[model samples]
Target: MHVPDGFINAPVSVAAGAVAATAVAVSLRGARRELDERTAPLAGLVAAFIFAVQMLNFPVAAGTSGHLLGGALAAILVGPYTGVLCVSVVLLMQGILFADGGLTALGVNITNMAVVTVVVAYAVFRGLLRLLPAGRRSVTVAAFAGALLSVPGAAVMFTLFYALGGTTDVPIGKVFTAMTGVHVLIGVGEAVITAATVGAVIAVRPDLVHGARGLAVPLKLRVDGRLVDAPAAPAAPVPAAARSTRPLWISGLVTALVLAGFVSYYASSSPDGLEKVAADQGIDAKAREHAAADSPLADYSVKDVSDARLSGGLAGIIGVGGTVVVGTGVFWAVRRRRADDLTAAATAAPSAH
Candidate 1:
């Protein structure tokens, strides 16, 4: 929801910051297991894509709009730990660079948008995958269900946070109702986007999809009135250099640029679910101006750019470029660290023997 400054008191904001920090730390460790050679590069693409997609806000209720929170989409396409890092990176970039979210409220935004949504949605997705049929269709279905629930789950978390540290006086019940109600409608948009994206990836390269990793049906054969496991065939090995993600990466980057640089211009200008609820419930009364309000990229418009379309387009392009660079750097570092650790372990094991 991109909580702005002063929405939450200092004490609660700091506490949320601590919580966000802890979650990131844990996620970093968990991501070591999630990100390998094949998937590490996709992490940055996922973050940039989430950032671009989030700019395209769709109308939900009459005056309210919603965008992809991206927790479920990220988790389904990538792994949960990496998904947290992806959204966290996007939030960090938006706050510091574009002034979309407040600097002071970074922790609150991260906790609600990244931690809660990713945790809840991934859990729901995994549960559904277990119960449903093992196929690409089931993965798509789980992605939709997970994303549909994550939005309201985040709304509830925000309401709970407000109950503890809201800056204004508003009935908690009323706040909860409005937040949950609007977000539920918003969840539909999230579900559709998630399903479409997940389905597309499943069709092209299911191996790249983290959630779909183990979903492929195992080989079997019927012999002597009984079914038995088929003899496993050795897979043809491709060299690391030959397994280039350049094509997919270039395509994804181009798509992200198109969405942010042009499609976002047609997105609804209405206040999103969080903003609408805050204005209606008076939670936005104490909202402070963003620290980067005067920055060249503030409000998604380039400085001194007269043409609305061109200004917004330029800013969106810059944002996508910046997010991709920073996110790729972070994920690459993590991936290298993981690789180094494995190498060291393997070397040490020989000496131990």
Candidate 2:
């Protein structure tokens, strides 16, 4: 959830900021191992896709709506470290550009929506994979379960944060109950979207699915009087057509544009799980205005644009474009840094004269 300013006291907010910053720093190092030439670009696409899908909020209850938190989907597609970075990028773009989340509470949003969701979802997913059958289908199943739980897990984390640094004197127990209850319903939507997206990617390019890797069971062969493992066969050369990610990337970008630019117009006009709970529980009593509330693209609408559809559409397109550009730049820089590190290490090696 996008925690706005004033919900948490300044002290806890700053502490959460430190936590979020540390998580991002750690993820930068961890993502180096996860992102390669093939997956680095996909990581950027994943962030953009998450940003697009979040615009299409679906109705969860009569007056409550939910959108993709995207932790499980990103983790399943890329690795967890990269997954955290992906969601963080989307949150960053939304906060600074769209004013969807508060700048002062950026750390709270990142901690709950990025760190908590990614860690919980990926942990559940990996645990399920270890216990269940190793197959594409199992990956989808685990993804659903992982996503289903991550939403409530984030809710719980937010509740705890609020309990510690809540601006108002609301009942912590009541808030926790409401937050978890609504988010559990929201989690259903998260699970379906995550499973479908993961299934689609697994179908097209299983190699690109970080969670589905190493799923090919090894073969056993009968030898003379003893059983032995079969030697691994060399991989066949893939044609340029099959090897290229251009098609997938193009299709995904187009789909994101369509969703954000057009389909988002029909999304439910209701409060999301967090907003509903906050309003109901008086958590918004002290909520402060967003610092960028007067920004041209604030509130997901372009400034001075009379047409609702036009204003929203332009804002969505701009958000998607900004997220893609920033995400790609970050991922490419990380990838380049890795390559540079390797080159420097090789150069520093001792000469064996």
Candidate 3:
């Protein structure tokens, strides 16, 4: 659902841009509470992982394909605010480097893909968690349900935007029906990927999964016909080396590289859900060329690279590397700001006393 230029009129596009900017600003503040020393680096890896997985588009219909939107997966693994930022970073990178999404219509893309998906999916996920059994499986289940819904939610949002500012005169009802119908099929793919990824992370390091935290029920004991909380067991001492997140980080980075560099070559070549719908419904009648189309890495192909495989592989690797570096720097700065704020508050509290 990378909205290209000229799809939306200038007035609506500017309004969408303002909305995206405000959402990003709010998310930056919220992320200060979500990111800390432990999760900040993990958040960066999550962005890179999402970027890589998105490259492996799976067939949804005969001629339509779908890929991971990453909103539900990222929110479940990290937090919603950070999740929005992660997808935004990927979109930004794709727009400027890969010429995938339109630079002019970036705000529209972010509003639909980042803001709407994250907001809706996280709400559904947390709401389900309250009703479902408290366990790792429940987290995975809720993630699937949330992801399933988020795709359609985004489709609806896009339809509304098109209704207001669509360049063509396609019927609103038809656009809505087609967009929602196709995206629902695409949502199935999103759900499976989100659930599997969430389940895997919960299995290895439940502590790192934000949604899986606090799911462990405390032990109970019955004494004298009355139930009481059992004494907490002392945690086994972990070696300093074992406690380091370096291994997990390295493993995640390697996995992203493998998927983007090689596995993506086998992904379906068909157009994705949005592209298919646009072409079929005449939504792209006025679509303009991407500004970055002349870039060396445009269209995921490296300039002067003779081998198609090698060129695509190099571009993927570069994208993953650049995303990780930029994302980590952004998150690290946010984390440091939080720490500084805490220190300042502590200093002022003593002076007030």
Winning model by lDDT: 3
Summarize candidate 1's per-residue lDDT along 258-334 as a digit string, tens digits: 99999999999999999999998889999999999998899889999999999999998998998888888888888
Candidate 3 local lDDT, residue 284? 96
By summed lDDT, which 10 consecutive residues of candidate 2 come out lowest? Answer: 344-353
Clashes of 2: 0
Query: What would the TM-score be for candidate 2 when compared with the true structure?
Result: 0.96
Candidate 1 residue pairs that clash: none
Could you tell me every candidate's TM-score relative to the true structure?
A: 0.96, 0.96, 0.97
lDDT, each prediction: 0.91, 0.92, 0.92
Q: 25-78 in candidate 3: lDDT tens per residue?
A: 999999999998989999999999999999999998999998888899888888
Q: Mark the 10 consecutive residues where model 1 has the least summed lDDT.
A: 238-247
The whole-model C-alpha lDDT of candidate 2 against the native structure comes to: 0.92
Q: State residue 84's C-alpha deviation in candidate 1, in Å.
A: 0.5
In model 3, the runs with Cα more than 4 Å from the true position are 222-227
Q: lDDT value for candidate 3?
A: 0.92
Residue-level lDDT of model 2, residues 44-84, one tens digit each, is 99999999999999999989999999988888898898999
**Model 3 weakest 10-residue run by lDDT:** 238-247
Instruction: List candidate 1 stretches off by more than 4 Å.
Output: 237-242
